[model samples]
Target: MNTFHPQYLNDSQGNTISVVIPLAEYEQIVKQLDELEGIRLHVNTHTGKRPSIPLDEFVRQRMAFSKPIPPAHNGEPIGSPLL
Candidate 1:
């Protein structure tokens, strides 16, 4: 079993830092945080391990992005490519 006492502090900016968490609330929060961290790490690892796209593929993707998507969807430049 663990115990925690609620407390509060004010910094130099006079901002109030309230500490009203009960022990049960703190435990719940910590458990949720551990789960969240695991999820974040999993997502980051998956992203990091994604296969690298070749340079030619990258250039082709960029060129396709730069061209005005024909609005003939309605005829107008969808967006300015530069900047």
Candidate 2:
């Protein structure tokens, strides 16, 4: 994991309200979160199944049914695209 240098946003009373990290770190975090979610979903879906497959195979199967994440374009978001 990359070491994050986060900037804290403080409220009027000096209470930390939010943290801002580098964009690269933020993107990496988001990607990791997505992967964790995928793993969680895969586990939930296969809880009682008779046969089991590898994580990569499960991810491939899931991706086969899901829409691909659109490439970021002109400052557009990763998953969402401007139609």
Q: State the lDDT at 75 in candidate 2.
A: 56
Q: Which digits, one per residue and each the tens of the lDDT, describe model 2 over residues 1-83?
A: 56889999999999999999999999999999999988887887788534568878877777777775656777565753211
The alpha-carbon deviation from the true structure for residue 25 of candidate 1, after best TM-score superposition, in angstroms, is 0.5
Per-candidate TM-score against the hidden true structure: 0.39, 0.52
Across 1-83, the per-residue lDDT of candidate 1 in tens digits comes to 54567677777898987667777879987998999988887887888854467978877777877755667566666675441
**Ten-residue segment with the worst summed lDDT in candidate 2?**
74-83
What C-alpha lDDT do the candidate models reach, one value each? 0.73, 0.79
Q: Model 1: runs farther than 4 Å from truth?
A: 1-17, 49-83
Return the TM-score for candidate 2, rounded to 2 decimals: 0.52
| Backbone atom clashes (below 3 Å) for every candidate | 1, 0
